[model samples]
Target: MSDATLTRIAEALERLRPAPAQTPDWAAAEAFVWHADPDRLEPVAQVNRVDLPLLLGIDRARDTLLENTLQFARGLPANNALLWGARGMGKSSLVKAVHAEVLAQNLPAKLVEVQREDLPSIGRLLSLLRVAPVRVLLFCDDLSFSHDDQHYKSLKAVLDGGIEGRPENVIFYATSNRRHLMPRDMIENERSSAINPSEAVEEKVSLSDRFGLWLGFHPCSQDEYLAMIQGYCAAYGVKIDADTLRAEAIEWQATRGARSGRVAWQYFTDLAGRRGVTL
Candidate 1:
């Protein structure tokens, strides 16, 4: 080949190849988010999370996750955790809150959030995190698999970690509305259609089993819902009479047609705005 042609081809090949993933300065922030399409980790200066004490109605989940996270941060053995259950019941929030709590205790832990769609890029992301100096609480919110979804295959990188195994400093915490990480009908369909029904269903449902800890969140009771609002009002110093607060909080949930920690926060937010309180 002519020298000019060879030079042009070399440059073209270089342009086509992706650049190495650059690790961010971990000291810049306590939390980061993984993004694909030229994969990068973007630091979050301020994480939008409720205070640990403010999260009510999930005390058991709260304590269990906190302990597990603390153990990880302290460089002890910990399990991959799956926070699964009812909608708006603080599954994701508890993960964030627990990270904050760990930081409060001066533990060397950082939070990294990854979107469900970007899961296919997780292996590349993990390559960067595995060498990180600090412990990583990798979080994925609202995780679920549909009947034909192939993204769950990529999740094995987090669960099994291939030959290297999951990085010691990296612990995973995922939140899902479905306990099995897939729909009931999907499992039932596999049960009926596959030649070996048990094996087929097991392959799908076994993803949740991979997690050593499965913390379930359930719907809050009326009293628990009201208590959550009152706690918010107290924490933010938004004052209202007991009678009025009770009546308004109940009406708010009635309009929404459900009761949960999120509903309480929404009601409390409205009350705070009306009372000229900034949260």
Candidate 2:
């Protein structure tokens, strides 16, 4: 080929190569994730959140979470929340549902779920969100740590609202079965082995105190469990007589040897499937 033609071809190939995307000004997005390797904020166009009404049996906790979330949405000072206590008691569900409720009201806040293993990346996440236009809810579900895991230190720093402090636009919400966000055995072991047993317990116990809001979820009574079932049935338009529903629900709870929102929902799903209904 002629030199001129080859040069023209090379120029065309270079033009065809994609240019790097601009580091988006955070104002353009309602939600984003921190991509650590690239050290950039990736915007999320759509979020998967449940409506608040669907979550039942935790009304007081729900109201508290909703208020805290709304305050954050409005650019008011809000505290980090630790939703702790009974298993399957709608702690995590409440956070997602509250996010949806606030968003439905046309609030600017967005929810970003970070896996428990991703705790160490929180500072990076906060850094990206600090200058963001929209408020952010950084949620970590089932967030307890074991004795050997030191990721909690990073979380502690993030929650301490470090030198730069937790980004003004972002708030942290975590759900765990343990109040301390650590296993009893792990805490106990530290107490047993440390030079100062009291200090050892305090070191681990203090992690939970970082969260200003502590919402505890207790086990629901039988009536509350049934109410949850009834609510689900009614909401889904599942047709079942009350007596039959109660009987089956009781049997299901008995077999599981426990009754919680999770168990109730599982039973409802099974019952719906058996009845050839969709939920």
Candidate 3:
């Protein structure tokens, strides 16, 4: 090849390659999103989260996670927490709220959200966070795996930390609808197909066991659901008669065929809109 052509090809190849992940300005924001292609931590000016007090149900999960996050932020011993159970019961919301609570108490903690697909790059992300001055809450929301998916293997880096060990300043928190972080049917399938059924299932199911704290979320009661809407209305200053609010909220859930903190919020959102209030 001609020298000029070779030089041009080399320059083009360099441009095509993804840039190395860079540590961001820790003070830039309280929260960030980890993106992998170019491997950057993008700061978020504001986090879209309900206030801690506004998360009415899942109080036990909320308290447990908040305490764990506070301990980690303060450089105390803590556990990698798995918040798993019923959907729309504030599992993910609890994680964010706990981080916010840590900040509220004047602790130096930053929240970095990682998408499940970007988990393969978590080692790089951890490398950046390992040197961070402030504590970091590494959060993954709606985490789950299909039968054929291998992303769970990457998650072990966060949960188990391989040889280098999890960073002292970083704590992992994940939310999932499944307690095992995978479909029950997937576990069943492995059991049925593998020659060593216990071994096959154990490899996958054991991932959840790696987390020291298992916080379970369950469906809210009727009163709890109504209370959630009421709290929102009060917090946002959307006033309505208690009877009317109760009746309307019940009707709303009936039509949707599900009652959850999420459903309550959805109903409250609609109510606030009709009342000409902004959330």
- Best of the candidates, lDDT: 1
lDDT order of candidates, best first?
1, 3, 2
Deviation from native of the Cα of residue 168 in model 3, angstroms: 0.8
lDDT of 1 at 42: 93
Question: Per-residue lDDT of 143-187 in model 2, one digit per residue for the tens?
Answer: 988868988888986688777677888889999999999988998
Q: Assess every candidate by TM-score.
A: 0.95, 0.85, 0.95
Summed backbone clashes in each candidate are 0, 2, 0
Clashing pairs in 3: none
Give all candidates' CA lDDT scores.
Answer: 0.93, 0.83, 0.91
For model 2, the stretches where C-alpha displacement exceeds 4 angstroms are 1-50
User: Which ten contiguous residues of candidate 1 have the minimum total lDDT?
Assistant: 14-23
Residue ranges of candidate 1 with Cα displaced over 4 Å:
1-14
TM-score of 2: 0.85
As for model 3, its CA RMSD to the true structure in angstroms is 1.9
